[model samples]
Target: MEIVFTVLILLLAVAASGVAARLAPFKLPLPLFQIGLGAVLALPLFGLRISFDPELFLLLFIPPLLFSDGWRIPKREFFRLSKPILALALGLVLFTVVGVGYFIHWMIPVISLPAAFALAAVLSPTDAVAVSSIVGKGRLPTTLQHVLEGEALMNDASGLVAFKFAIGAVLSGTFSLMDASLSFVLIAIGGIVVGLAVAWSFGLVRRKIIEWAGDEPGVQVVLLLLIPFAAYIFAEHFGLSGILSAVAAGMLMPYVETAGAESAATRMQGRSILMMLEFVFNGMSFLLLGLQLPGIVGLAHIDAQMAGNVPVWHLFAYIAAITAALIAMRFFWVWFNLRLKSFSSALRGRRSKQRALDVRLISITSLSGVRGAITLAAVMSIPLAMPNGSAFPARDLLIFLATGVILCSLLSGSFFLPWLLKGLQLDGEHQRQRAEEMRARARVSEAAVRGIENAHDKLSTQLDEADQALLTEVSGSLLATYRMRMDAESDSEETHRVANRFKQFERELRLEALRAERQELHRLRAQQEINDETFMSLINQIDMAETWLLGSLSSSN
Candidate 1:
């Protein structure tokens, strides 16, 4: 009964979130709101309850969310933005790890350096879900949006690789710069190789099956679904980047081959499945985070009363500290890079340079650091025990801290982001916003046109409305011309259909012309021309006969 009830509530929560998404002034993403609501509901004391564990977290959350996100981001975009992606993913993550690790050790001598580094690694990668939730909706310029998204995606790979190295260093009680460099290079290369192999193999199977059989149901989709986890696990077994493997596999899959149409039919069928998995897993992970609060707070209370001054919920402190560290680091990096960029786009002063660099965009995105479900899931899976029998460096503490940051960042960012936008005076010139939406619509129209342009003449949508109707007419005319052009070269079914249509319309016009000539002959007879217009009548009859012959010829053929 409890399980059923919880599921019902979560379903309600998702439904409510969908409504809130449209109604809210600020574009608070549905996933972010679901998490915020879960936290709020948990405060009621008697409102809701659930149990959570590391296994549940690992088994349920990461793969699907990561896979879905990876699939949606195109491979070309990923490769195109590789430079900025590397800067944000590898360079920025390393900078955060070293800077935060040193700070934590300095702030609390009681914590070991390894423990501090562990803390740094855990907090290194910014959550893509969070960034998308907080900053990505109907905001930012296109280039920056791409940069941030690419950063979020690739950083998971870089951060996870760094994390494994940090963990290994902790276990072995030694760290080496050379080893870290070699490990990152190898893991990245190896993961790409493994992931590409996995993606290519699946692509091959998909091609054969699609060629032999045709369209598949959701089961084949499921096989595609597991690619991420399979790639991740296999890569990790060989000491490579599991996160990268998952990301790479997803990123590569669509471009390779598929059994489904890039049409409305497939999208309509697959949309529900994709959305359901994402929604259910997202809610479960956040709910688990909320569930842990009770257990963690209880333990911290006891720890506080022990010979300590105030038991400083050090977890919350760490969450805030690291969250701050991330926020500060991003802004600093953005500012510095903008200056560097200004040199190339030089002849602008420093303020002009900064303004030219986009002051508000840098600030808003920096503050929009909303940790979310993925971060919670990863933190929840931290091992409770180390290899040597000591506790995992602040394991419970890290979980608590990560959860706090996720909640804090999301709630505060979502609720306040509107005000920040307004305050920055980045509010004017919504031309870009309108233009983007128009471009999106144009893309659909263009795709439809392309379908008509092809020999297959296959399209996914039912066309209507003024814009679409106009597009359909234009495409029909263009296709007719194209087929006419092709007729001189070869005879194809597509060209024949178009040619038939053209002939049919032409014959109708000829019949109309002949009817007009017959009426003219009657008018001539009434006016007394050449003895009752007999000669003109005969001419009109001949023209009418020719029209019928041509019209009939078109119909029969």
Candidate 2:
């Protein structure tokens, strides 16, 4: 009951689930595992009752999560997959909402058309987190992966807007196709403009701060964290889609430098922080859902009679029907799109390997649409009462239905995706991609070696012969290490043999350097040349340098 205690317990649960996931003998999707943990924690013996404030959840979680995802996505790949992304995120979402809305209204007459549409919209956007957790580790075509990710990023905005309009129709008891369409366009455009403006302003300020601060990695990453929340809040304040604002803000970040020490540290630290946040937030989200399961189920049973005499079994049936419809409609839409593309290619008198890839991509994409947190948030955000303060028609049933669909979609996707992957023989171009990576690594190594040589040349002019020889020896060893990596392949025994020797030598040199640095810093402190604060700071820097060096050596090996 105590807030602090409750928060601690939830965090502990998240930590335990994470550890369990890592230690499990077989692969288990994290969301499923976390949700299951929550369900078990909800038992009477645990005395745990988890409740989520849907608005708070959306505001606190969605922006940062979306922004991090957006920042990670390559602009080039996003554009490359734009056509399919649009087809799914925009086109398929619209189709699903309208088509499924009508079907739900017809199938369950107790639910109003607007309410049915709201339900449809809530279920429309596939959670990228869910899809990635389920399918990211498995071998799938990279293009398909990109399309799925891109679609998920964009569709949250589109789906939430559709949900808003549908809720508007329900409350106002009026619907205008043309006005709704116009409003949708305006909201999307305005959200994008606002997001860009906010991000641009923040980026300018960030650059100024970095210029003034002289590239503090900690400060840089802190600033990066604030951009998404600012964009989300600003967009929401203006009655636009905050989700899109966050996405846009993330995508708008300037070209990131990867070569410098400070830049590398910033990138590494930022990635790690984001990943930790993602793990905690995603795990907590599912756990919260599981916590609410008993309550929602209980409510469903209590309100079953009120919901047009629909029994629990009927709710289960509705879930099955809607999920089936969701999957089937996606397949149909994808099939239609592929057919159109093939037709156009034929008319143009062109044939290529991409046609075959398209077939496989269609299958993968159709199956990748697993609903998760966003869907639950939207459904739960619906008000229980209308303007007149009477019960919103079938609100409980709608929640039940949405929750069921989420479970159904997640379960089905997780079960079928692996099997489908096993059946398909994919030419993922593994060899080609590896070769490209090797070439890129080689270029980077050459640049590093050149920089080291220039440093050696400068040092030679300043130091004695013995020191100069030591510098030359160090440079040569480093160069030899990179050269070894350049020609090494993980699969080759000869390469491994050479790599092992180089790695051992490199590790020894690095450890000695680390020891010398520590000794010098401590000696300064002992001689009262540096204060305690300065000594600790220098020691921390040494630690970071040693860690980075070790990491580099390990990766090269």
Question: Which candidate gets the maximum TM-score versus the true structure?
Answer: 2
Report clashes for each candidate as comma-separated counts.
0, 0
- Candidate 1 RMSD computed on C-alpha atoms after optimal superposition onto the true structure: 16.1
Give the 10-residue window scoring lowest on summed lDDT in candidate 1: 302-311
Flag regions of model 1 displaced more than 4 Å.
1-13, 16-32, 40-51, 259-264, 302-308, 311-318, 343-355, 423-557
Could you give candidate 2's per-residue lDDT for residues 137-235 as a string of tens digits? 537766667778899899999999999999999998999999989988888888888778878887777667766767778887887788888899888
Which candidate number maximizes lDDT? 2
TM-score of each: 0.70, 0.87
Cα-based lDDT at residue 40, candidate 1: 59
